[model samples]
Target: MHPKRKLTTVIAVGVAPLIAVSLPADTADAHGWVTSPASRQDQCFAGTVACGPIKWEPDAVEGPKGLKNCSGGNAQFADLDDDRKGWQVHDVNASETFTWQLTAQHSTSTWQYFVGNQKVAEFDQGGAQPPQFVKHRVNFGSVRGRQKVLAVWNIADTDNAFYACIDVNVRG
Candidate 1:
């Protein structure tokens, strides 16, 4: 090799390892999750219930825009899909406030709340970026007893949504 080419190759080899080391080992594109009324992943994060990887990343339960499962169709978070898991059930009033703790806010389309197959509440954002924290007043209406509420944050610019499931016992 030419003298100049040999020098260039030596510099490249020395700088490559430094560049790799300086880069982040793992990057988190986490969004958000229900903090109040304590969603399943939140329960796992808080150590209220024994869980898996979700304990470290409760804010990352995201999947495709339309999904009905608690784990957001993520197999790693499949623990959230297990109804038999000893999840803590909060006793809430007929009208309860659901709060979201956003790690990273995104341009949002809507926030939807559901019970079984029924949509109980929806707040449209119209492509606005949300704040670090968001809360919605959702009335249980006639829904009572032990129930699981699914909350979804639909992103306006992406074909994905952040999901969470909160277990509650609504007072009559």
Candidate 2:
């Protein structure tokens, strides 16, 4: 085989995986947020087994994510690109462990957040097509903070059980 041809093939083989990594996957947005809930009647329920909404003071506007520009539907959905209040959490705890839930009308889910709620992340789910409902999990990331940690849940979707209500749960 030609030297250049062999080298080209070798390079292609090595770079093929890298290219694939860069490319987004088809199921990428499979289980992600959607506009399923038309209004508050859709779903509602969060926190540690009916204690009330996850109470937490806005530590700070550390982030400006989600659909802050758009309007209608669930405020959480509207908060797609940015937070409605443009609030960012701050002074989160570094060491904490708990398993809470974010249940909705159509589906119910739970999460185990640890290392504080500093940079908490969520995992959303979409169905066969885009514009699916939200199914998020995770405590943001391992980014822990030390100070007056104030954790909270936006309660985007609603659960029929306790629809129109929101709550938060924490354990250590």
Candidate 3:
């Protein structure tokens, strides 16, 4: 083989595979979600919930500016928005402490929980940095039976938030 042809062949064989197999940039943030009672992301990461890329990066459910959907406004995480997914329901009393396991601690403004359209609880951080584990004692009030809770973690510096949807049976 000619010198140029041999070099060209080597370059094509080595570089082409790398280009073809390369993934997108690492846009994953190290934020987190509820894990004690098992949030949807927790289930996905634990192989209980069938999910997409989120199964690999459970702590990366950051959303667009000011959008507080069940899936953190990310279509990749849309499985969390579905209530009929047969998610494992954790049984809890009216008042219970829910914990968020943070992979990367970010300055937070507040954490809020909602049942349907009604706000059930809020924990204000007041733009302070949080610990690796942030706990909130939430009360479901008069709610009973199977319920989906939407949890939001508002980042203080940015306009985005982390979201987690947890299915639970509210036992009186």
Identify the candidate with maximal TM-score: 1
lDDT of 1 by residue, 1-172 (tens): 9999999999999999999999978876788999998999999999999899999999999999889989999999999999999999999999999999999899999999999999999999999999999999998899999999999999999999999999999999
Off by over 4 Å in 3: 1-29, 65-68
The reply for model 2, stretches above 4 Å from the true place, is: 27-38, 41-172
Counted clashes in each candidate structure: 0, 32, 0
lDDT of 2 by residue, 1-172 (tens): 9999999999999999999999977742112111121111112111212211111211111122221122222343332222223232222233333222222222423221222333354333221221222332334234433322222223234321111111122222
Model 2, position 70: C-alpha lDDT score: 21
lDDT of 3 by residue, 64-107 (tens): 64555668878888887777776889999998788999988899
Q: What is model 1's C-alpha RMSD? A: 3.3
> What TM-score quantifies how close candidate 1 is to the native fold?
0.87
Per-model lDDT:
0.95, 0.28, 0.87
TM-score of each: 0.87, 0.24, 0.81
Give the clashing residue pairs of candidate 1, or none: none
